[model samples]
Target: MATKNNVVAFQYPRLTKENYDKWSLIMKTVLGAQGFWENVEKGYTEHDVAVMLNQSQKEASQNERKKDKNALMVIHQGLDDDMFKKVANATSSKQAWDTLQKFFEGVSRVKKVRLQNLRGEFKKLEMLDKKSISDYFGRVLNIVNQMKRLGESMQDCRVVEKILHSVNSDFNHVVVVIEELNKDLESMTIDELSGSLQAHEQ
Candidate 1:
């Protein structure tokens, strides 16, 4: 276990394209533990003192302001120079978080277009005659995984079915046997089918 001092001094993981999900989750957890996540989620609203606040209300407002600043500084510390510049002018922690998200995730329009293109590529994929089974599976899985990462609702059975139809004619006999034996496509896993085909290849 880390000592109290070590835990307090812990550095957040840097954000990268590949690590966005993990990095954001850890950052949210850390900020929540520190009592600063509210600033990022709901934002800090400035109090107009035209109407006098009661003593307790004043204290609460001061605490909120402190939390917001702390949250902003922690976010800044975790960013590299380029990312830092993007959020430098943000007036609140929520604004900073939004800026970073937009920078990393791109606009919804772009994601939608990319998702459509990925779907097209997935539909058109075929196992080339010269490609090894592993290589062909890798190609198919690359597009499938990318689609999932981008928030597509791709099911495992859909992938399995695609593989059944996309393999080279060399595996036609095994494919037919597997399809005829397994009436329910969803009952067979990708690994089991791959292993059976590999054994036949050997």
Candidate 2:
């Protein structure tokens, strides 16, 4: 645990074509720490700007709007000329943040490498012999989650099927029963599969 006094402050990394994956995380942390992330996450729409707010609501909106401008200023300062041009038309922090994310995330080299590595790990993942059902599930889910975080569009059914197909021979009966329950296991959630297997384990 880092004590407040011992913690060293980090400078937010400037966004570049190659560094968006890592920069985005740091930017989110900086914006969150400054209490400006809410506006960046949920910007006002055109309808919101057109509507009349009551006195209390107006005051609250004003405060939030100030936070938005502050967040935008930080983002603007963090960006280089080329990146700034990309978001020049954005009117709100959310718009700018989203524009940056959409433009860079798909093209990030680091993200691609990490995705490849995660995919390789997921492909080789299997429940080791003598590992408890929960332990094995934890390992499988860990790799799946990491892959998901790297933008893998993994569905619940795929995870269910992966778990069902990969467990040890000790679960041969349970696997067959689960497969029979749903030939495709289309609706089975990860938790649901874990529960059924754990019940059998007991």
Cα lDDT tens digits for candidate 1, 1-202: 2358556557777876556668789899989999899889999998997979999999999999999999998888778887788999998999999988887677555778999999999999999997888888889889999999878998778998999999999999999998998889898888887887788777
Clashes of 1: 0
Point out where model 2 deviates above 4 Å.
Answer: 1-107
**Candidate 1 deviant stretches above 4 angstroms:** 1-85, 91-107
Models 1 onward score TM values of 0.56, 0.51
Backbone clash pairs for candidate 2 read: none
Clashing pairs in 1: none
RMSD (Cα, Å) for all candidates, in order, is 6.0, 14.1
Instruction: Please report how far candidate 2 places residue 191 from its true position, in Å.
Output: 0.6
- Model 2 per-residue lDDT at 75: 88
What is the Cα root-mean-square deviation between model 1 and the actual structure? 6.0
Tens-digit per-residue lDDT, 1-202, candidate 2: 2347889755557887657778888888888999988889988543377798898988887887788889988888779899999999988899999998877756766788998998888777788998899999899888888888768999998888788878889899988888888776887889999999999988
